[model samples]
Target: MEFGGMLSLDFYLHQNPDGGALLDWSRRLRIAAGAARGLEYLHKVASPPVIHGCVKPSNILVDVKFCARLCDYGLHFLASQERQGLAGYVDEEYWLNKSGASKECDVFGLGVVLLELLSGRRSDYYQENVINIVQWALPLIKGLKFSELFDTRLAIPFNIEPLVRLARVALACVGNSRPNRPCIAQVATILTNLEMDLY
Candidate 1:
């Protein structure tokens, strides 16, 4: 049960001194893959499907091998078609309506978290007018300019293929058309394929 780390995923990602060593590009890809897998398990593998409701870097813990295990299920709730409203974590579409939350909401929040990990900044902390992390990264992602948004602290020497794929996945998750967003299982499968290709 002991994952051999610090208090929370946010702490591990941001506050830990050893974080730099584990937060490199390769490890980031792996952690992203693990997160996709976790979401896959929740949405497809589990009965009755669980919606995390909040998916942020701080909620994701890194293990000894740098594999990620999603934590802070404390905010997780059963998927519903009637409930609505969660802070920074809720999907944009759900914000305007009283309709319930779903797995897609988690997917949107995960996209924001992914961008935060890549950019090395807090989701809410903005440099300019870009209030949210995803909003700022969207243009760079769509234009395929990896360097524009990637963490400059780390030297990324590998072919940026995986990062591009992950970006696409994130975009799909935060799609303006909510119904067009892929399910968690679909997203996980795509990530798994990307991971396999990296080997």
Candidate 2:
């Protein structure tokens, strides 16, 4: 598989080459759905079940067609040792349990990525404040302030049902406790349906 002109999802999270948002609502949904499917495959279809260790924007590469490809999967052992950039991506249970990375951790990371995809804000900081994406988005998502959660770069779509559903999925992945978090398979299913609805 060659990502000749592929760019990391992080590239789209910020300003595009044209100084405008490259990811509109539809493209964002497609990327999210594709990324979910990739992770679901790794966790369920892959023999022995692989843990992504770190699931962040930079690890998800988007091709010219906006196809998401999950990279650096099953690197928990090395990533857990470094623990440098894994700050906001990994779940709290990972540090508390000391059992190493798990599927739940990956879900939490994807939730963060989804939040970043929704809002143009980075995981490291929101606006000028040093708040994690989950911390910043949870309240807005809970309050049903869907408008505020959308990235300002993209005009809010008239039919917001899909975006709302995606937000709920992100909330489930990050806001819920590890035991309560939906597995990647379930997330992929929801996102797949949402993507299909876009047509």
In every candidate, how many clashes are there? Answer: 1, 0
**Model 2: residues >4 Å from true position, as ranges?**
15-20, 80-83, 125-129
lDDT of 1 by residue, 1-199 (tens): 4767534556656777776566777777787888889877777767777767677777777787777788765354454544332455567676575654568777887777677667776666424564766677888888888898887777765687787888788778775557777877788788778767777
On residues 84-185, what C-alpha lDDT tens digit does candidate 2 reach at each position?
A: 778788888888877768999999999998898888788874235577789989999999998899988789989999999999999999998899999999
The top-ranked prediction according to lDDT is 2
> Model 2 reaches what TM-score against the true structure?
0.94
Residue pairs that clash (backbone atoms under 3 angstroms), model 1: 10-58
- Candidate with top TM-score is 2
Residue 112 C-alpha lDDT in model 1: 73
For each candidate, what TM-score against the reference? 0.83, 0.94
The alpha-carbon deviation from the true structure for residue 24 of candidate 2, after best TM-score superposition, in angstroms, is: 0.7
Q: What TM-score number comes out for model 1?
A: 0.83
